[model samples]
Target: MATIKDVARAAGVSTATVSRVLNDHPSVTAESRERVLAAVERLAYHPNAAARTLRSADVTTLGLVIGDVLNPFFTELARAVEDEARAHGYYVITGNADEDPRRQDEYLDILLEQRVAGLLLCPTDRVSPLVEEVVRRGRPIVLIDRSIDGLDLPVVRSDNATATRELVDHLVALGHRRIAIISGPTSLVTGRERLAAFRAALAAHGLEVADRDVRIGDFQTASGVAAMGELMERPDPPTAVFAADNLMALGALRWVRDRGLRPGSDIGLASFDDLPWFEFVDPPITAVRQQTEEMGRAAVRELIALLNGRPARSRTLPCQLVIRGSCGERQGAQ
Candidate 1:
């Protein structure tokens, strides 16, 4: 609770002299500097971070707002971002939008008010006016995992098309002609691109996804469970199911278990994201793993570049397909 005045009184120097010593001004005598340092240590006096940040145009704090908290993918991403920011001598404040656009905007506003040096976010909506305004004002922002349509913001995202194709082709080669997909919302770029990739891959293999075979999920577990239920209740359920994200994939697995059906045997299941636990599950899952940690670190690099008045470019990290028993023995890429 010690203030600048307390430090000044303890140091037997003027507040201006303490300020000069704290700022490392060359004019301060060695004797004054030692006194200020001793006082600071004795009182455990901490400078006002907000005031210090405002004193200079440089920002020592960064902000991260993720689209979902329940998804372990985003949680890992947040951790990676925080670690990277800390390494760069910056502190990070994270917010979970929980897939709500309104909440996403609110978090954005809060960060802006805090005067964060830069922002890294996985946007929940197609377009946010607050984000657009921030961009127009030339504030540094890096988009991660997802992006809006027209915004020209720097981004770090997975190349889902190639990976989705690999997964679908692997399933096709396994003799799964009728493939069902649990897709995320079409409103988001990741959702649209992934679904498009699935369809495109199937078409290339002389197959098609029927309207009934495609179930729309909100990128949440409950929606995944519901979608799986609907697909399973069909007169002719698919032989293979692909969930676009890990949580949905887990939801699909739960539905399969509830029916006493085993994946890789009764029905094939594949997913877009992979976790350590995925390999140890009842049937090790087949998945497309994105460079999640790399994506977070890259986003920080891009934002820092922008903060330094350098041009920030978009990044597309590749995803690798990891095949296992859950998808019924992935046949080599067709």
Candidate 2:
């Protein structure tokens, strides 16, 4: 059977545009409407009856999809999003993507099927075709934490480049010439930005980033453990190592402890994410602190603006570099 998607493709317009033309929405341009009608007639396209019925139902909810629920950063951000949503007279339904693109797509599908008003997504490394369709449909979607290339969606995230440079400078200032980094997939914006910044920072100090100094991680504890193991076993290992996130930092810490290596004296350690537990460890971890609450609130506000037919702008909040004992210093010395 001819479907709405087919009509949209044939007309060279978004499915949302086709819907607007069919429903006589005043915002649609006459040229778009004419094209859509011509394509519909040629294709004999019919919108799904069930989907139309579902979309007609009143929607007072928003969908929030996070990268991973186990990550404390995401857990805190979700709470802040929910709080802000309630204040705006809207309820939020959250889905944990668990760092999987397929799971993220499934959540997005379920949310759209339920006719949620809008979505806040912490995107995976790659964008899905369904997400492209959603964008073309003119649905309100605010990206939180991560972004995909070629998408003009509003985004709320940290200033990763500046924060990473600061972290690297600290490591260099501590007389650590040979430094290494455990980073997430380069396909992610955060991963790419941090890795680039690390290289730039090293270059600024008249140092080169050797290929062996960079280890690809999955932003998970297991990857961190493996990367740390590999780094420590090298013929000439790095004197300092930076993990891109808290979970990975924890993994690195575990590996260091299991091998009877002290963090500050034996080798330095740092992380991109700051957690409450960092302070309680034997040697506290130095980290970059992203404003998760502010990010969440900003994402909700931007999404709400879109819902109200107002223009929404992307925002990058500043990050704080918290120096602690793990990075070759006493907790309060720096």
Candidate 3:
């Protein structure tokens, strides 16, 4: 086993520098840090995380607890957080909590036991006790992509309600009288807020959100397929459909094709969260684009500021509805 001295000597830097990098101190330069890491790898020196934590009494790590790892949105957010933390000389420990507050709480406790310097979370359930516990512990923290009401921590989120409302308004302007919506779990803040906005947008146009036209799923492809099928069953089927996430949108598109209907041509569609694959599909999907990358970078900037003694606050970035063929209303209809 290679020791810290060997790593330091091979990298041509002092042991102190190696220790600083290992400790994830923000002052370590990236080039020097990479050299040290390369040396450690070449020497096959694996630092015992437990031993290091016990000896220094500091974890020198950050934690990111997300709701769904399978969702590209969460995956992208986690990637941004991890990259930023690494840039700041901190290793990030990430895991999905399956959107259960209980699972989230458990993961929080585990990370706390590990004594990570900070955490970024897309929380599940009420999450007050977990938030209160972290605050009580005086750990540096940032909330991402969602907010917990009655909590004092800083947060980064896209303007969910306004964005979805704009999508609804666009469809209405294009002359879609009956627009159906498929959403993720309403228990989560994003889903709940988006649903609220969807309903409000319908009501604003004097359109009733028929119960049969609305469906709730887990933001998975299967759910989207099922929801679209249900909507198609309505006595007066919707003229347009809005899927709340990309996976569901893909599923809806699949069902439309299965029925020999062309998307954007035969049955109009609009959705939230644009996927890269959308551009390849027949007529590109019209979507309400959330500033996902911006949201990620902003969360990192906010988290870093919080770590640097900045006062905490929350921010919601704007989303835009892009006009595309999928959302164009039929001509010469009724």
Clashes of each: 0, 0, 0
lDDT of each: 0.92, 0.92, 0.82
Each model's Cα RMSD: 1.7, 11.8, 5.4
Residue pairs clashing in model 2 are none
The 10-residue segment of model 1 with minimum total lDDT is 325-334
TM-score each candidate: 0.96, 0.83, 0.82
| Candidate 3 structure, TM-score to reference | 0.82
Segments of candidate 2 deviating more than 4 angstroms: 1-57, 331-334
Please state the error at residue 255 of candidate 1 in Å.
1.0
In the predicted model 1, the residue pairs found to clash are none
- Identify the candidate with maximal TM-score: 1
In model 3, state the lDDT of residue 301: 73
Give candidate 1 misplaced runs (Cα > 4 Å).
Answer: 330-334
lDDT of 3 by residue, 1-334 (tens): 7888999999999989999998688999999999999998899988867778887754558888987787888888888777777787878888788766778888898888888877888887655597787888778888887777777778898898988998888889888888888987787677889889999989999988888878997777898899889988657788899998888898899889899888775778877887676767778788887887777767777777777788766788998877677876533321
Instruction: Write the residue-wise lDDT of candidate 1 on 1-334 in tens digits.
Output: 9999999999999999999998889999999999999999999999988777777787788999998988999999998998988999989999999999999999999999999989999988898899999989988899999988999888999999999999998898888999999999998999999999999999999898899999889888998899999999878899999999999998999999999999998999999999899989878899999999999999999998988899999999999999988878645542
Candidate 2 lDDT by residue in tens digits, 42-154:
98887775678676864679999999999999999999999999999999999988988889999999989877899999998666887898999999899999878888889
lDDT of 2 at 184: 88
